[model samples]
Target chain A: MEFNAIYVIVAREFKKFIRERSRLFSAIARPLLWLFIVGAGLSRLVPSDTGVSYTQFIFPGILGMTILFSSIFSSISIIWDKEFGFMKEILVAPVSRLSIVVGKALSGTIVSTIQAAIILALFPILGFNLSIVQIIAVILICAFTSFSISAFGIVLATFYESYESFSVIMNFIVMPMFFLSGAMYPVKLLPEILQICAKINPLTYGIDAMKHVIFKFETGPMSPDIPLIIDAAVIILTSIIFVLIAGKAFERKG
Target chain B: MSIIKVENLVKRFSDITAVNDVSFEVEEGTIFGFLGPNGAGKTTTINILCTLLAPTSGKAFIAGHDCIKESAEVRKAIGIVFQDTTLDKDLTARENLIFHAYLYNVAKDKMQQRVDDVLRFVDLYSRKDDLVKKFSGGMKRRLEVARGMIHWPRVLFLDEPTLGLDPQSRTNLWEFIAELPEKNKVTIFMTTHYMEEAEVCDRIAIIDNGKIIAMGTPEELKKAVGGDVIYIKTTDNASAKNEIERLFKFNVSEKENEIYMTCGMGDTCIPEIINTIGEKVISVRLQRPTLNDVFLKLTGKTIREETSSGNDIKDFVRAYRKRH
Candidate 1:
């Protein structure tokens, strides 16, 4: 529970993030491609009954995807640290193991949030009008989503020994999570089994909560199948569970 | 008071015992060395003492704190320079030290001054702003040493501190390590395979195959090899060894064509030994015993022979050739 130790870890990660200019570029590029190319192209092929444009409808999903990818990849640095021997220094320090886990999780959250914020700044170009309340809601939801996803990443990073194995496993899990979360399409239109899978996904709650706020602001307040309160509850509960699991995994001998 | 105590400490990895029934004591403010060949459990013992790896049985204490039960206190009281480089390559030297200071909970106001002091101590203050990735191997090792001392722990554990450095860099690093006890009042527990490096230690424990074979001061261990070693090369080696053993009443071992034995004042005995078996003696050599000779006498093999399968000697040879 030493806040200084946590702060120092977070500060070092941020310093590394800032220095790696290429990583920052890729973080923004991936979401923009989905928004401009994928959203625009798919919208022309399949028209939506909702009055909002396809670009507007998928904006929140794109933001969620950016946060998901960035936060998860951020935790891969743990494996790199282990390979390079820096992790041993951290493991032997007087700080509690929980602080190291929390510090890494928090840094990933901040990095993903920053990446999401960059996408949020482009709202004007996308021709979306938002009130002060909706803007605050979007930022808050992004933070919560980023924190949850980053914790999940830490849990995986702890168990994985090498980047090759981690990358393979992440691709296996990440693609399914992203596709089934209804980021590209609405869950209501999916088959029964697909809908059930989407319902169980923690990310489904995040995107649903964001869509609720964004769509409500664009149109009148629409009652989604999953209420905002339920989405918020699931996101918070999942985050706590992930943080605890990651802390336990990190306590194991490296 | 002993700064470190290990009693019957054991560590096993599934079927193999990496450290077995090890026992030793390191007095405060002295450099205690573990000299052995590779895979001889030297690093394992150091890891157990540092709290990075727990012993399977038995016990260890650092600064009177149990390494297992009181790991937090033990961790706070000791610093470690791992065999491999542990500094963050992307960060500058100052940033790396600052991060270490924070992790050890150095006071916020004193952090900058402490970082500066350690950087200066390692003589890397001039390049503090450069990224560690740009540093030479010796520079990186020096920085790791400085980083380990940033918090000023009561004990320092250096695992193969100069494993891959050139002779000059190794000597330079030893100079810095030798001064740490007097300058910083830190007790050092180090493990090295190099016989020459072990000479700097106040006392050394020679380990092989996960057991301590001998423990004492350098001079004492060397003396344990007997007064002197005599190597006699003869046309008929077996006859010469038998002749010497019968005349001098000494035990002799032969390898290849040379008959080797230890005798009191080998310089004085060589002439008598040659004269007693005058026609048999082709050449004779008399020499004082070294730590290598001590290890050979105890283990029946030189330290380098034990490590022929490992890369330490190969890397040493490569580094030596590169320098030449």
Candidate 2:
């Protein structure tokens, strides 16, 4: 990626986020709602397992949820770009179109990471302790997840004509990824079919990986390590593939 | 020398040939209008030449770079302001220009200065920090023009630059566009469905049905059919058309509810032409056949009346909304 272009794009996205406070509010609200209300209620309903409290177990899920909501919603700008004619200006620019796509994805990723971090910060308030390394790890994981998801969002933006259609697809694809990834409940507790589905879900790997580090009830020793690496790889790989797809899609006029 | 050359360029979307074997050359440092009826392939041709859409066949070159093979170079040399407002509504006008400047790889310090200059040029300096969504349609369009100038490109592609603006806004935009050639030496290649809009160009290529039927200086095109046009308004327009066609045996087109015909030797012919039609002609006016007639003479249709219904799906959205 061209660093200058990337910086500009990210800066633009950040400014846009700041200007559209309602949009930011909605993005921040959804995950924060999930973490507070849904996670709180569900934790009491399910039998506690594996020395992980409800908040700790659910922390990783929120990271995936954060990535999912923020990344997909970021494609809203693409629709706006097409509508407002800024896209034509961007498309006709002298720079590599790939840089434009990467720039868009990076912008989305950075914002998504910040939103994810905001949600993560709520953990200590809810009575879970995160090590400095754990906090750093989750940020990277969330950022990567956001990039991959936002890249895919851009790919969808090329094919979708309206935000209604985009939101429908996000509901169809991302909502399922969240539920199936064992975001609310551990995969071991799901039905056999859902469990199978969860294992394949990139979200599952992300959630499971984060679970290895989050400390709740101060009971668990240093957690599992290898799976987080594997999950990180999946996210990085997905980011690479979807970003390339987005770049090609942006190059297309129709 | 021609700064932009398009030869036998064709583009098809499934069954429709949006752009047929259209060919034209644009001289450097002159404003060349690409005129056509709606759906007349003006936008399609512009899109192809700007490297946004690939031509089905033939070729186009911008600033010596082939559009297809050297797309990036073409992109660098040409700036496009699309017919649709392409502003980032969330950003201020200045911010939007800066984004475009950075995309074109303008230096950071220079980006600020250029952003200010363009905003000033568009007369949006007062609203520079105002979000674009708050601006009027004309304001947004001017900002789009500013965005196009961010890179300081030599050739600018404007696809229907003044469409949908109020008459006052259109006039403002026209005056701004008219000054650009003299001010910046920018080779302006613009497409417009509006016949009157093309008249402002130094030269225009009137295209219809994916073909350029006429290409020349606006005056030359009008003079080719005749030195000027004779407008005869009558309640019996059909009869008047028949009588005129019978006498002159020339092509004609109508616009704005007025029937117009072109003829050579306008000074001498106007009196005879009016007398032949009888005095029932409520008013007789003679002026140059406009770019509109040039378009009509080439294709057997009026350029103003042919609005493109490119997709049924877009219609469905509106229809579905009404039903609900």
Candidate 3:
């Protein structure tokens, strides 16, 4: 809650993230591959129902992928801390477990948002244009999405035993969520059950929102930006839930 | 005055009773050694004292602040250098110190000075700008101590402070820690598995199997053994143990290679016993018992010489994780 505590946590997380150049590299690469290579190649392969360019149709999903991956991958740092006994140091400090959650959430969400920013920077170059305010809203959308997913990752980190096991779990959890969240194709592309599954996915709203921003997909059937607002709400709520859970977990650890 | 007080402190993890009914007071300006073997709950006790783990029941207070009720104050009052290293290897010594200062909310103006002061105190000021990843084993351990001091804590908790150090480094750290009381009346509570190491503490509680076996100053504990010690080098220790048990009534404890007996007047008892058991004797020796001897008397087991070896896979990975 205090300024100095927050600064220490943020600065430490920042230092850790930057010092591990691999985290920086992988953070950008995962989304780029999904958006450019996977999204672009699959664009021509899938029949275009929306009648939009393949890359354009999936831009939302790709951006959502950006948020999901960044948040999940940042958890590696947590595992690293546990392995290195840094968690013990942080645990023993004068700061509250709640502040720790806040600090990790803030730094992780911001860093993940920056990864999305890298993708956003490439968006215009890829010929997807947005007005300046849309750009600001997009960053906020990514931030919230990242916040929710990263909070989930942080909670998982407490339970994670080792880096290798953490990687396996992350793959199982994150990859499915990425594909199932209607990021690749519209939810309509799936079976009825999958569509139902998509309805529960928080990324669906986030992706749908990004899609509206990038592709202007809200025409007659869907409100211009209803999904975005809904996704944003779910993300904020989930982030709050995960932070509280993580806070309680850390409190017990102390 | 006692700077630390614990009353019936108990800690449990599911069915495992890690520490039970452990209570002690550490006097101000005194280094209280908490001595125990591996799995002896030494770390758990220190964890409770340092506010890192709450007792499942009972209470512990640091510098008069309750660990449960006033954890924030307790955390502020004490510094802990855990058995495992906890420094950020990616950062320089100065950066690491400053970051810890920020957590303690040291003023920005004072933070740099404190960082400088601690680094110098640890004899690490010259290498303050070097990355910790580049540091050797001793350097990393020293930095952990320096980091704990950055906030100028009123008490310091060191869990197995020299568990994995070479003899030279261990000696250096002991001297460094022993001087803290003179520098300031900072109450020092350190856990150590090494029996010889605990002798330097003003007082020690010998803990084993999640309980305190004995508690006293080194001299008091040594006095607990009474007169000279009789160490019997027995090829048949079991028979030797039973034979010695029937022979002396004062106190007797045996291990693999030796049978030890303590009596009221060893000068009179020892020679007669040596004469009585002459034919079966390997050798007889009468000497002063060290803390190790006292621990052997209390525990009825040899003081284990298990060094913190990195040869084991688990230890290597754990140590590697601490650094990398």
Candidate 4:
């Protein structure tokens, strides 16, 4: 059965992730730097009319940013595998292409969620008093968000075979997704066209779901842009669709 | 029995015909080599047989499984060591083998034994725990070979297995590869531009420009060249070429200031030529026909004339674009 193949691909990627200590450090460090540096500096200029401070306002978005970068870049290993010739080893095996795609998505999900959890753990220091239920809810949202985004990244990975091309395209998509995703500001504040773009972005709903769980604001300027159920549903549905697309991409290549 | 068969195989990349109307059969339990220069379609043929490529318009079978229709089965029956190193540099040597075993669906109970046995077969057991990144080029290659064999494939496809190794390492790696078919009863299908390396094969097909120009055993190929070769460098090669042809009635060719020709008895001809030739005799040497000579005799050009730089660019471009 290809279950063993999937297990081994995941195991191999996880082993590599662990061996690269710098990756772990940087994954965790990137989110915290934004929280302290950007969040602190922007908090004074952007006054919070709502009860929450600006730093507290953007906390969930910070977690979303963590997931966005980690989940998306995790599939960069595909480019690395191609460059280093390791992809040929896996491609020539008896395993189905679906198994390989599922394995990559799962590993990226796990790795990204771990980084998100570290950022979520800093909530207390950032002055948010969260109960255990909210923390679990946030972790669940991060996992779903990471899986969908990672699968999307895999779809992008299938288009190009070089690191330079992949990075150039990633920067084009990732930064705008972050800025317009209501991560730093509310979606309502964006220009109409960009707000449309933000609404279409999967990360927007992810961060909005985090807000729904953390703040529990049902209806306010500070409330989540989309309903909690809708956010969860969007993430789950996109994850399936993206995984199928990536799987088909691999199948067509062979 | 023939383990691999290709009939009228053709693979075209838009305008370039990489493997054009190729046909061959590889016998079971014997080393069969595809001898060709870079971009002559050696790797392209191997890729088609290994199920990594679908031929443009032909049928290929591996162990009775169709390469295109039954690719998964074909893949299961064959293992490939590509031209470049494919080992996971961050993983230990044993980890790489174990990963490969798992991918091939090796039984969990037998996984440990097979991994250990293959590592030992490659003589890498002592350094099984070392990361591949720490290994030298030769060690990484040995580890790759060990990984390729962990699943006990019926046919092992080695594409330029010794392409970039030092002489000692090349010989060392060949020792392990040369022992596989005899010791393990596995049919080995490999490709090499190295004429000496082609000599190890039980049978060879000389491919050039996407077509098999000649196919036979090494001895048969050498015998086809006919007679021994005598190369003479005189102070005046123009006169030497004319003098030798005129006196001995032999067909002589001049290349790089050296006049050479094929003669039935080079031992006797060398002295006769030296005594009769008018030009001053500078140096003389006689050699039995080698595979290089066989190649030269067929194509009128040495295989070494085509450098490997073109293949490097092909690899680079292949890495930059998705395979069609």
Candidate 5:
């Protein structure tokens, strides 16, 4: 992996992401809508005995949603590159295919991290207070989640030839991954099958880790369903697996 | 020494054999053309040579590196302008070139100088700052060519570089392409179905139905199809052909009210032919054989006739939509 080759690809992708103003606007706006409108509306219905506001409960989930949507959509540029013939240029370069994958994955991770940071700015508004340590932990978790999901997007992008097919497949997978990850509600309260599905979702660990950080600060004693160590381990392992998958898929382009 | 060499290369896509047992060599510092109609495996052969598509059997090498086993080395030694425009529409021409330079590992300090030189070579330096989407088709094609050359590779592969351009732009592009060998010391391997375009090449291989039917310099291939071609439109064409055949001991073919004959020297034979076969000649045309005629004589059909079918039209439209 030539560092220069990787840097060149990363720079091009970042430039495109920054230039598209509408995309930036939407990346921030989509999750905020879900966080405020949906979270606020649902807060009224829940009983007060849970000891956490609905906004604070769903805040990590919204952060996961922001990272998920932004990172996955960043990979759509690969489909666009294929259609426009720019992919041939990249594939034929002297650099290894791994560099291209790294470049793309890192750029997507950056975009999603930035989007999540924007949502994080509303922490005071949601009436949640946290230490500097918790903020750093949340950022690191979001980065790992963004990297894994973006790698998954690249794997899907490699198989799809058009934007229409990619979007269709994304909708089918993304919604289920977010909904079943216990982003909206507690996994302990869900039915047995749904809880099992949540355990399988990699995003579940990401959100769980974040929730642990926030609730640990608020409630003083930590009692996460999954240990923080296990959550971090799963997210890191999933990212490595996805990066390998994406690299292999890229090498097999026909 | 040969800059490119292929031995019995074959590429198959499911039921279709895109390139079938094709073998050829391109010498260093020369322009080699692959002339074929659409779907005739021209692009497939180029792709295999450029290491974009792996051959199903046999092998190819670029600058002495096997395209498959040593693809990285081969890629380092060669450049490619694909059949379609590959420039990033969102980036300016200079940005596109700069991106390629870094990808190829051109030295950081030399990058600006190299980009400027190639841009000026293609006469695109003035428009370097404008986004590629604002460029004309000719400008975009020129920028693609410049981008391909940004790394300063030893060889350049252009797959149908002028496939869809106006006459003026096509001619201007060819002028720029023709100069690359002498000016930049880069060997060119290009593919085109157009006969006139192949004439500019130092040597050409005419491919049909996934096979190389003829290979030679343009003049040598034309001569192999015999000398000048004479087309005669006359009253009583059958008798006229027979009379000319008997008088000149030449093989004449007739197709729909016209008599076609290949002679050693058409102009020298024309007067004797007319005088001997008196009064029946309405008109006579004597012309040198073109690559199209060479293709026709070798494959029994013109390139256009082979691809002018209804299905080909649909494929053409589909390809057009894909490119635009």
Candidate 6:
């Protein structure tokens, strides 16, 4: 609905994204710090059960981390827009709430996917070779994961009015989701209660799916926490559901 | 013909009624001003008319479309310049208009031409490529007005379009807005606290405490006050006020340190007031009734007293932030 409205929103975001060079730099640099500094240091002590190196074991988690931060913060633009009153201009336009939600989700997905791809290109530097097919699959997985998180972020954004309150709430939600996502560690190593939380987090499926693509073997303790089909299904289903919820949330703006 | 209509609109925020049983019609191709003090439901009424808010009861229609049921059509038919600046400060003036055009679904072929025309109309054509963050307060407001009209909606709602601008810029922006009804064939429904700005409107509605206290052309409203106004500042205002009320039998109101009253033939009454009142008068002035006087007579409060309260600090901060 109102496809041009969606296009304009996407284009406007892209222009702002390009202008803010520091944001792009920081988005890329944060994940690299985790991958190189944290992953490299932990790789020595946290030896993997599988033949895969510890650096490679958490590499998928690194990608998940990149997507999680970038995609979720992309919705922060909404809070900024609200603060600056630009959201009122858009809300008064002849566009559907669905178009606005889809446009935001698409822009977030694209931006986070681009950041994830930059990190994915570092596979050679990490001494792990990925086939072109595997690389494309990983990118697709990153896009789906980013879309779901972005939609969920939009859903949360609708409930907030100020950057301070939203940031406070985001700290409460984002950090736990990251820790429980099996991003820095395997789900099997987690406490039983945390394992339940990991199962609930959509990002867990995302990182697990990334593990399926990058790792050579699927039958080990370090293997994906869930089946590939289940991971994909959860992400796709969550994305659709979050987007619908976000669209409905916007209706209450009236 | 009436292009905008509201039938007994009432909006309540929890237990407080922000807009209560208000109804009015705006004719096509005219400038209708909504004059009210702060929190007088002016913005609330505009929000409902623009389809940004739904009323708890009653109905509003814009350009023949029901504001609640046919909101999309109403949105398509209206453009608003909010009391605060809403332009994307990161984007260029041209890009902002183009974005608005797309959101309003302007024809692809005509989009560029429309954007150019509006930029030129607002006199921001020279700075079209510059980021809005670099613009002065006045320039940003002009661009917002330009963007509001780029879509050529049937009605343009301006909620205090020149609230923060300097007096010179206010006059300049007001000139552009005053021309829209005739030059662009668009109905203008604006809310402002500036009495001078409200004077230019084809019709004015003075709202207070969520009610429309008076509605008419500026002349008609001012005439209803039925006298000239006299301002007296004396050494003793309490006795001066009581003395003026006793001697002239006029309804006296004290604002700040000055005592003012509305009385017929104020020109002749001024000398009599100075001579007969035993108190030493510090100053005396007489003037014809203005829209502010009418508002004061109706509401027992001066419109300027309410609006000018916090403006100095805001002006200072804005002036300090100006970049070249």
Q: Using lDDT as the measure, which candidate wins? A: 6
DockQ for each of the predicted structures, in order?
0.83, 0.58, 0.58, 0.71, 0.76, 0.66
- Between prediction 4 and prediction 5, the one with superior TM-score is 5
- For TM-score, candidate 1 versus 5, the one ahead is 5
Q: What is the Cα-based lDDT of residue B166 in candidate 2?
A: 96
Question: A1-254 in candidate 5: lDDT tens per residue?
Answer: 88998898888988887888898998898888998899889989865454777777889999999988888888768998998889999999988878888888888899899889889888989888888988988999999999988888888889888777865866798888899876888777789999999999888898888988877443321225677889999999988998898999999973
TM-score ranking, best first: 5, 1, 4, 6, 2, 3
- In the order shown, the chain A TM-scores of the predictions are 0.94, 0.88, 0.89, 0.97, 0.94, 0.98
What tens-digit string does per-residue lDDT give for candidate 2 at A91-118?
A: 7666677888888888888889888887
Candidate 6 lDDT tens digits, A1-254: 89999899889988988999999999999999998899889989986678887888889999999999999899878988999999999999989999999999998998999999999999999888889999999999999999999998998889888888666756898888998998888898888999999999999999999998998897777878898999999999999999999999998862
Which of the numbered candidates is closest to the native, going by highest TM-score? 5
Fnat of every candidate, listed in order: 0.92, 0.90, 0.86, 0.94, 0.90, 0.92
Query: Where does the lowest 10-residue lDDT sum fall in candidate 3 chain A?
Result: A219-228
DockQ for candidate 3, C-alpha atoms: 0.58
- lDDT values for all models: 0.87, 0.78, 0.78, 0.87, 0.86, 0.89
Residue A229's lDDT in candidate 6: 95
**Least lDDT summed over 10 consecutive residues: which range in candidate 3 chain B?**
B315-324
Chain B TM-scores, listed for every candidate in order, come to: 0.85, 0.80, 0.79, 0.85, 0.88, 0.81
User: What is the RMSD of candidate 3?
Assistant: 7.1
Q: Which stretches of candidate 2 lie over 4 Å from their true place?
A: A49-51, A83-85, A216-226, A252-254, B229-285, B307-324
Candidates ranked, most accurate by DockQ first: 1, 5, 4, 6, 2, 3
- The TM-score values for the models, in the order shown, are 0.91, 0.86, 0.85, 0.91, 0.92, 0.89
The DockQ-derived docking category for candidate 4 is: medium
